[model samples]
Every structure is written in structure tokens, then in C-alpha cells.
Target: ELLLTTYAFCYHFQSDDPLIKLVEDYKWIDFFDFHWRLGIDGLSLGPILLTGLITTLATLVAWPVTRDSRLFHFFMLAMYSGQIGSFSSRDLLLFFIIWEYQWNLIIHT
Candidate 1:
């Protein structure tokens, strides 16, 4: 929902902007992407929004899943922590750490 809505909004907003149209209409820039019709339409804002929302809701939902409240909480917290790290990471190193953390939880769980 967020992705599609943001993409639609951005595309429509830039549809009338001269600068956006200039880049889209350029020959050289358009040549390499000739076969590829899709391009960044300034809708990257959607992912930014969706990532945050997913991270937040996932954390909230996972909290109640672990009721043993001792060792079980560790995996829940660990999983949530990894999810947050995954969402915030632009760097490969941190993302890998988070990815591994989740797998670690799955194995232990």
C-alpha cells in the first residue's frame, strides 16, 4: 500500500515538473535504458516509509509471541533487533549481521 501509493503520488507530482520531464525525455540517458522502460520516478520515498512501518509493526507483533518470558524472550528480542538492524542498514556488513541473527534465532527456536 505504501509503496504503490507513494509511487503514484511521486509519479503524478513529477509528471508536470519540467526538470523531471527533461531527464525522462533525454536521448543519451534514455538510450541505455531503451529496452528498459522503467526508471526511478522519484517514488523512492515509498520504500523509505514502508521500511519504517514494517520494522515498527513487526516488533510490536513479535512481543507477545514469546510467553515463557525467559529464554524465549531472547529469541524474540533477537529477532526484533535483527529486523530493526536490517531496516536501518544501508551498509552490507550490518545487514549481514542482522540477516545472520535471524537465522540464528530460527535454528535455536
Candidate 2:
């Protein structure tokens, strides 16, 4: 996770035009636009970096799990994905969905 964040930071800064937007439009429904749009910008970078740092630290601190280790790690990964998704989502619906998913994971855990 840290390595990925570092790579993203480097890629974000090194480019002359450091705007990376990935868009995958899937109109799965008839009325609404279901676009899986993600991007990294100056504002988004801060939270992404912070989340990476915190999650790395949390993983290190929670290394000595006695039982259900796989489940614990799975939750961690799910939460991390939700956070990163929420931070990088370019669409409002995507953002809301990720946010809700993160909260739901937290609640269930």
C-alpha cells in the first residue's frame, strides 16, 4: 500500500500534466449514468497519502492476531479499498457508494 502510494505520488508529480483520470462508463441502467470514474489530483492526494500511512501503521500494529487472521486482513483490505475509492472517485454516486460501503464494513466489524 505504501509502495503504491509512493508510486502514485511520483507519477502524479513527475508528469508535466499530472492529471490522471480513468473513466469506464457502463450504462447498466436506462436512466442514470453509471460511470466508474477515478482520478488523482492535488486535493485528493493528501487523503490518499494519509490513509496509506494510517493503514500501514494499523497493519503493523495489528500483526499479532490470534484467530480469524484471514478475516481480519480481509476487513482491513476492504476498508482500505473503500477509503481509496472514496478519495479518488470522480463521480458523486461512486463516492457515496464507497463511503456507504466503508461505513457498513466498519459497522459489521
Candidate 3:
């Protein structure tokens, strides 16, 4: 599933519309007068692909392991979610929140 998503992402990416905003809202919350925002662009492409590829590979590599495999995969997925969120986030607060979540997942894992 991730591999397909990654391939689609790469295949559909357009240089002309590089900077794509996923979210923008004034009612989300104002932190220091900043609203929540999420976006992706050319600069973020590398990180997004890298994250997807690495996580997919890691999941495949660990698939046969029997020791606490469910927990491991859960954390791995959570970490990936946080990473993707951070990479695509345009708002500083959202990025920081995801960053902290990833950090915690790493520590616990």
C-alpha cells in the first residue's frame, strides 16, 4: 500500500504546482497569531519519498520477526505518520507537534 502510494506521489508530482497547500484555516487556532497550515513542495519531495521508502523497507524487513511484532509495527507506523506529517506541515506549531510525537515514538520503541 505504501509502495503504491509512494509511486503515485512520485508519478503525480508536478513541478508547476510544486507548492501544494493541503490545509489553511483561520479557525484552527492562533498560536502567536499563526494558523494551522499543511503543504508540500519540491523542497519536501525528497523527505517524503525517503520517509516512505525507508519505512516500507523497514516494515518488510521486520515482517517475519515474532517478538512483540504487533507493538513494533504499531510504533513504526506511528513514527511514519508523524514523519510524514512533519514533512508536509507548513505551520511551525504543527511541525513541532509532530516532531515531538516522533521523538516520543523513537524513545519508546
Residue-pair clashes per candidate: 0, 0, 0
Candidates ranked, most accurate by lDDT first: 2, 3, 1
For candidate 2, the lDDT comes to 0.81
| Candidate 3 C-alpha lDDT tens digits along 1-109 | 4777566676776757746734355546544676667767778878888888899889998889898988888888888888888988887887898899889888876
- TM-score leaderboard ranking: 2, 3, 1
Candidate 1 vs 3: which has more TM-score: 3
Q: Please name the candidate that would achieve the greatest TM-score relative to the true structure.
A: 2
* TM-score, every prediction: 0.39, 0.83, 0.79
lDDT, candidates in the order shown? 0.50, 0.81, 0.77
Pairs of residues clashing in candidate 3: none
Q: Which 10-residue window of candidate 3 scores lowest in summed lDDT? A: 21-30
All candidates: CA RMSD (Å): 11.7, 2.4, 2.7
lDDT of 1 by residue, 10-103 (tens): 5555644433221222232444442211222334334545654665566566677655766665654565556544644544544676689778
Stretches > 4 Å off in candidate 3: 7-12, 21-26, 30-34
Q: In candidate 1, how many Å is residue 36 off?
A: 35
**Candidate 1 CA-lDDT value:** 0.50
1-109 per-residue lDDT for model 2 (tens digits): 9888888577646445656643344554456757777777767778988999999999999999979999988998999999999988888888898999999999988
